[model samples]
Target: MSEQADLKRTPLWDAHRRLGARMVPFGGWDMPVQYATGILAEAKAVRTTAGLFDVSHMGRLEVHGPTAREALESLTPNVIGKLALKKGHYTLFLNERGGVIDDLIVYCQEPNLYKLIVNASNTEKDCAWIQSHLPAGSVLTNRTPDTALLALQGPLAVTIMAAAGAPEASEIRRFERVAVRLFNNPAWAMRTGYTGEDGFEIQCSATSAENLWNALLRVAGPNLVPCGLGARDVLRIEAAYPLYGHEIDDDCNPWEAGLGWVLKKTEGFIGAEALARLKESQARQLVGLTMETRSVARQGATVLAGDRPCGEVVSGTFSPNVNASIALAYVDRDVTDETLTVESGGRRQNAARTPLPFVDLPVARKKKPAGLTSTASL
Candidate 1:
């Protein structure tokens, strides 16, 4: 009772209960892990048609000042000074020792204002760290408490937007955000999502969240299903997107973790010097693995190359999209064996080294002309 009482609930908490969502504690919040449709079904819906997610638990912050650009440039590895208005890029914040503080998206909302969305678990830490680094005149405001974020993800998401009273949302390019209307209410809509699907993440006031959520569902009708965190986790994992504490963390190396792309210019950010110094010593490569058996390998499970312990699993789950249990792990860069085994629960399961993104992203899949069909039964 005390634990439940201590957990915070999002604006749509009661709505989730009404939909028969299974509640679980996540990042100090009582969130829905899955709905009545189940995790697999919800995940499949996102990959096929569309799915709606209540991602209000993520932290939203706004920074404003004449020195905002300079302050952000000094803090992240990605180049922030070049971001045009309404454009956002994935970036990272690191400690002086080259350790990741958090991975977040930095958006240029205005000439002097920027919006940041940080991980739910890292929100407080990120706020303190960011606030301390800003210039004297710069100000940081935590908008998470007053914001409600909803993600409409899948192939049908774009079509659903216009019907949901946000026609402008469909025109927003990827990574570009715009102020739009959701069911006639103002919203901040961005063409971004974590599910490796085409979608938009809509941010609105907490007071408008429930109304917006219901309106979108009503407009989409049967095309969109309500998804929960369990499906969200599976989708992100299948896409090989790193979770904060899993693939990338304080002890993890961006270079070895295949996150070198985020380092747009390696020598400018706070951790550049340390990263340059430690690159050679961090000799592990983040790799994807698919289990040969039904056994699921979880984080901290030991990876072995023929009998020698080579690495450990960082994140793993049964991917319904891939039809197998898959995992991401860090292994010795010199280890060349593709066949590996994960030892957990007193047993070893054979797993084969697979490429990242066990499932192909929707954008990469081929399409046919509107009237074309794939070789009819003639």
Candidate 2:
């Protein structure tokens, strides 16, 4: 591991250290992996109540122009033009060979303007790719340095936001974003999160980040548990959300990750032809696994059918909610409904085919209302 002085840090670095968080290096940044209370407690808090996460490490970009939508659509598998104002959806960026570059959330702030929130690890690469493919006259602003992100997640998330002087936040439905005054500071609250729970991702100016976090802690009071990347990872894994460099990467396509729904087949984007070929001639596919024993299957663990190795584990964990070991793995397209095994510590443990998302999501995407609000009060 590199020295702490060599790594980048978010504005909330000091706050995390003060809380006795366990710091670690992630994507060239020094971040908190877990707090003193531990990952299990923090993850369970998000499941039953609410938890706060400093996600400022993630990248943010603002794009706008007459050709912005079309330009973005050309780079991603999702249909950017079809995205409605103030709405956001999960999308994937692909390489020329149809492999996933990164999975991100694209929010339509206006007809021609959009807000892109991408993974921390792929920030630089994703920005460079977008800039290189940007149309003439289109504008791209990297707001990662100027902005700070916080996720207030779980069933009690809305209540916490409403109590924190952002009553408008409670009104924000799934996949919607609204700009409002949080702790009297300008902030954007998106009704989206990676925890598979009903929550909001709030973005505020870097200058007001600590104040906003402190204010939210006070407002949320005893209901708020400060979570770290460790808990965040476990939660997303339980939700079956793909993480870059893990479940999906530059060498893997959406089809292999069970994310074919994000692909717009008719709309020709970058790598569309490659994806079309994969669709016609399917190969390996991502699937869920439930271990029959207590042994947890780790990443890169070989999955087997009897004596034959068939797949490899992408992400696996001992699920707190499920009270069992679960995993996501990629196996041959022909393999289905067969008993499988995973090798851990030279011992082959029994596993069975299970559905994606070991646990069901508490929140579902809401339908867009007929009359959309044009102006967001900030």
Candidate 3:
């Protein structure tokens, strides 16, 4: 079999090929890494107007039963007790030692139904972990093979979505979702995305993905272009969004990843004791680094504090939005707020510890329209 045949393909594989995308293997799946326009162009398009991403490879799973919420709470850091119906929260699945298994987005789609969007590579592991910890009456279903995921991101995404038969797009607020009809098909439209922009993630059937994609293309026209994983990585890094296996992984805990806020000590959950201890001990910390030069520091690059090794770069990329070389790394808490040197491509570049989200979104906390209230129904 050809190398390409050995890799799994999403439903939009033909669409990406038709658009002349540069296909690559990502998380064991044949995915488009970029288009002919390049990552730089794709990033700019999303920041300025809108961009469409075929993220169908991401894992989608369902947890249902009377004890679903309790089961999920036992596995993730987010307080599931506080989640309202149809509301979503960003959470992390942690190991017994307080290390992150995967960062995920969980949505309480209904009173007893919960939906989880996990990293593509860790789908099986995440599902197994949840099932193993689930209560006796709870049930877990992996729907990744049947679901299609798409992200429409940018300042103008709402306009494009509204025009493409998603009139209720104007009613969904951030971290909220609604069951809506698109192109005469049912879809779960959520006001959330990886890019630090106003956007929506549309989930539907694999059979309906192509039709909706084409319809979105027709409506977005020149303003929205099809992007791929390469651009997604750069844009997410610019926004300071953590990536699984990069900014966080099985060996990294929430305290060291700058995600301590998500852990509510009062709420008894898995890894609570270990997390509390880590917070009190103050061992390591996650910090952002900006390079003095344009030479990018890549993952696994050695980070030096003066003459000694201090840490390793986890996620590093050439940020198209900031026009700088940026990275996220873990360093000793005491070593934070200090200057360091990074070895990239056999050259040493000066770097300094900076705050998370090197590039801030101007209106991250802006209020949505009145019609976008949480209680609004489609």
Answer with 1 or 2, whichever has the higher TM-score. Answer: 1
**Consecutive 10-residue window with the lowest summed lDDT within model 1:** 369-378
State the lDDT of candidate 1 residue by residue for 44-147, as single tens digits.
Answer: 99999999999999999998999888889999999998899999999889888888888999999999999999999999999999888988879999999998
| Candidate 3 residue-wise lDDT, 54-163, digit = tens | 99989999999999988888888778979888999989888878889999999998888999999999998998899889998889999988979999999889889878
Listed in order, each prediction's TM-score against the native is: 0.95, 0.93, 0.94
Ranking by lDDT: 1, 2, 3
Indicate the residue-level lDDT of 361 in model 2: 84
Of candidates 3 and 1, the better by TM-score: 1
Any runs in candidate 3 off by more than 4 Å, and if so which?
Answer: 1-3, 265-267, 336-338, 366-378
The Cα local distance difference test for each model comes to 0.90, 0.87, 0.86
Collision count for each candidate, in order: 0, 0, 0
CA RMSD of all predictions = 4.1, 3.6, 2.8
Q: lDDT by residue for model 2 over 329-354, one digit each (tens)?
A: 88888887568989967888888898
Task: Give the clashing pairs for model 3.
Answer: none
